[model samples]
Target chain A: MKCRGLVSLLLLCAALGWVLVYSLWSIAFNPVGGSLPEQVSKAMADSGVDHPITAVLLNFRSYDTLLEIGVLVIAAIAGISMARLPSLEDPAFRTHDALLDALQRWFVPLMWLVAGYLVWAGAHQPGGAFQAGAVLAATGVLMRLGGMPMGFLQPGYLLRAGLILGFAVFLLVALVTAVVGDAFLAYPAGTAKYLILLIELFLTLSIAMVLLSLFVAAPVNDAPESQEGHQ
Target chain B: MTPDLFYAFTGLVLFITGLFGIIALQHLLRKLLAFNLMGSGTFLMLVGLAQHRNGTDPVVQALVLTGIVVAIAATALALVLIRRYYHLAGRVSLERDATDEGRP
Candidate 1:
């Protein structure tokens, strides 16, 4: 026991030492100069964009956002396909627990409201599509854990449409911009803020649906042997 | 000392802990939870990196956001695989090690 305790203490000390070294190195070697927050704030001020998060998510790296949406859609599709437990008749799946089911009943709707608020608030604050989608997905997970019927949770045609809506809107915006003699996805100078917000809103909806579907696709082991034997 | 650095460090620690959990745990659900912890950690790091001066490079934020989406997608796929594996094999882990060999 004494030996084991000594070994554990040594391990803990090593870990603390590593973290300290890494932090010190990072602080000393970071090439970026000036206060990051101040510089970022100043840059936003210069661009006349009011919200920093919006400016970061939409304006500075819009393409990355686009691809990120693609990743979400792809993951959702992949997960649903992988689970392969088609229809609710499969006996291998088990339902959620009673307490969880009751909690989910009350929590799902509230989460949706919170998600909507987060998406809307992204215009001038820290909330945005990603955060909103995460929140929305959390709600879906709650319902999923509650075993609240597959029909309500699974990704149907409407869910698929929602998943792509943001991409569609973004594509249209880009196409229109190109037609008007600007680079693709380039908002008219000064109109970027609102346009970006529009894009983010659609993206948020898409992301939320995609994430929820992914959660819903999680497989369960309650399928009966009759169904299993067929497979 | 800064908030970003502190958060980043916390995220890194979480990520490593998640990695360890994923490797150490045998339950599929537990593994999935660990994977999620790691993904969230990476996301935290990415967001922290993006919070740099010069207006928090939209590019990095966008990339990180995309990564988060992709991670969830991959996680969904993994969960599905885990469920299917459990159904077919009657277990989530590959090994019959003493820790989880008796688990149902």
Candidate 2:
């Protein structure tokens, strides 16, 4: 036991030491830097947002954000399908209490407000659709944890609509831009702000839905037996 | 060391720590937490690198923002999978033999 413990400790120290040395060498010798940021931020002066990060996310690097939203959607879909059968008991079945109700009343509204503000502030500040969406998703998770019925929380087709809303709008915008111009996502001059805001709004709602669905999964049942290649 | 380098080294430490935890711990939930901690460390390093003489590099900031969103999505998926595995196998650890395979 003592020998094994000493070996483990030596391994840990060696790993830490190696990481420290590598980091110091990079920081001191290489001093890594890049110019793409300054150049792009300068070139895209009319990205229609005062905030540079927002411009990059929604304007300059909108393609990446679009694909990221796609990734989120795919993950949500996969999670739902996997958890559809042979799943654990839904978190919604948990017992609720007055304390939970009080906590929801306090935190849910605050989160909603913050979500709204984050989206609105994205144009000129440090907040954006992702932050807003996360706040909303947190509320959803909170509701689920507090035992709110899934049906009441998401309703029926409305949830699905919200889930797809962001992707539809983003694709639509990209297609229209492509038809009108050479670039796929290049918005026509003087219309970037409104279009990006619209995109962000839908993205916020869809992200919230995707996240919630991923957390809760579609309620279904199958025998939770060991199956071959379950690996 | 400069503040940014200091933070970068700090991130290295944190990433290593989380990596260690993920390899050492048996519980899936704790491994998930460690993975998240590693992500947080990476984010911190990105922020540190983005810190410039004037301000942060917007490109890095944007990338990190996107990363944060993606991380949550990943976490949600991992959590659901973990929960499913736990329910199906009757244990949280990923050890193959311990997960009901020994039952007749």
Candidate 3:
């Protein structure tokens, strides 16, 4: 019975793939959207950033970035709430690899420097808050695996504040700009660069916090087994 | 064919493979992996299709960037949920009748 189901499912998937590929081929050959690159280049001067991706993310279509950060914060909150571990630094959970320890000693500070550079380089290049924050989070995860004490990640006021700080600040800026300027997220003349930089700074920190907290919130082996009838 | 078209077709293949994996695989973790593969395929198609028309379009690139970050967060959250489910049920797969206590 299971084999029969699998065969049917495979056949259905093959048909679906055929249809999808046909649609994509037609769409790819004949694009429908107007020349967005030309439009972006025309408005690039007023976007307050040298890099086009940065300009679109932080200036032109900032609403998407803002909501993206909001989603991260919510995910972090959910993960943290679900984490019921009594202690994060249980001795048995530590990995005592000599090579990892040695490499970590050499790599942590370098990673931090690279993350900072990425954020700073966002104004003119491909690096930005998301990339920088991911690097920072990776560093934290390495440190955690090496059994470094991360008391700040403990579920408390500090963790909560760190999780929400980026989204809060971004939303605040959007509201302030809306009230002061002509529309939401429209930075005032001459301050767009500074506003964007400030938002990106907080965004990097909060993004790292969210990712790291989610990493640390995974249930450990010591969690009590769920009783069959218990909630 | 242009590089964009090539990558777009590659992404289409990955998307279909992921779709099959998600439906045919019983393990929650495998399902999550399939979900991510689907997301990557979609991202690749978005950038490849958009840039096939306009060389190096930043708008689509930025959208993909946002998408990548969101996808990471989503995958992480899904892993957390899966881990919790495993802890509670002691099973890796979500079959209804396969909840034998010692068979994780």
Candidate 4:
């Protein structure tokens, strides 16, 4: 029976592969999309960023990035709501390893430097809020593993505010533009660079906070399981 | 066969593998991994197809970056939920009979 199942799985894989290849071939042969690269380049002067990806993310399609942050905030909220771990640092995770302690002391500051650099370099090169936030989150996770206490992540108004700060700031920018008789999220002439930089800074902080909180909020071992919602 | 097409084809294979794994695997964690594999495959396809015609499309790349961050959030949330479910149920698989057998 196991052999038969394996064979059937292989057959299914083959069938799907063939179908996908055919579709890709068809799409490649008869392309219907226009030249977006050219269009983006043409509008690059007004985007306030030298990097095309950064410009697209922060200026040309700011709404999508804004909504994406909102989604992340929602996910963090759900994570913390389900997280009733009872303490900031779980006993199971506590350790006194000298190597990890040394590593944390050495690496944490370096990671922070890299994250800041990524945000600053995003306007001209291949770095941005998302990348910086991810690095920051990784650093937080490392700190947690080394038993560093994160008191702010405790379920409180501070954690809640940090999680929503990026989304709130982005929305405020959009609304401000609209109030000033411009389209929503449209940066005014001569102020686009500063606005993008400010938004990126807040966004990096909030994104890092959201991801790190979610990581910290995961229920630890020895958590007393409840039967409240069980059938 | 350009690099773009090669990556696109590789992504197709990953997508199929992920689809099969999601269907065949019994463990919820493995299923979640498969779901992520599918997501990665889709992202690859989006970038590959866009760049196959237009050299270096940053718009799609930015969109994929957003997709990646969103995917991480989703995966993190799902993991928490799964861990909570496991704590409550004491089973990794979601089959009804498995739970019943364990309880009984």
Model number with the top TM-score = 3
True contacts kept of 2: 0.52
Q: Taking the tens digit of each residue's C-alpha lDDT, what string does model 2 give over B13-67?
A: 7777787778766678889999998898888777775563335688888998899
Interface RMSD of each: 5.1, 3.7, 1.5, 1.7
**Model 2: how far residue A81 lies from native, Å:** 1.6
Q: How high is the lDDT of residue A25 in model 2?
A: 53
- Over B1-104, each residue of candidate 1 has an lDDT whose tens digit, in order, gives 55765666667777776776676567778889988998888777666654532335554555665676677678777877777776767666877667676665
Worst 10 residues of 2 chain A by lDDT: A220-229
Error of 1 at A189 (Å): 1.9
Sort every candidate by DockQ, greatest first.
Answer: 3, 4, 2, 1
Off by over 4 Å in 2: A1-20, A27-37, A85-110, A147-156, A218-231, B52-54, B96-104
What's the C-alpha lDDT at position A75 in model 3? Answer: 93
TM-score per prediction, in order, is: 0.70, 0.82, 0.93, 0.92
DockQ score, prediction 4: 0.67
Please give, for residues A1-231, the per-residue lDDT of candidate 4 as tens digits.
Answer: 767998899898889889899998787668676799999999999999899999999999999999999999999989988876665456567777899999999999999999999999999999999999999999989988897777777667777788898999999999999899489999999889999999999999999998998888788754355644353
lDDT (0 to 1) per candidate: 0.68, 0.79, 0.88, 0.88
Model 3, A97-137: lDDT tens per residue?
89899999999999999999999999999899999999999
Tens digits of per-residue lDDT for model 1, A1-231: 646865665576458557755864475347765554565566675342566656666765566677667767777777766665664223334475888877877888888899889877877777888898788777766655566654544346666687788888887877887799478766777777668778877887787777776666665446553376567
Q: Given candidate 3, what's the lDDT at residue A175?
A: 99
Candidate 1 C-alpha RMSD relative to the actual structure:
5.6
**Residue by residue across A164-203, what tens digits does model 2's lDDT show?**
7898899999999999876899988889999999999999
Compute DockQ for each candidate against the true complex: 0.36, 0.47, 0.75, 0.67
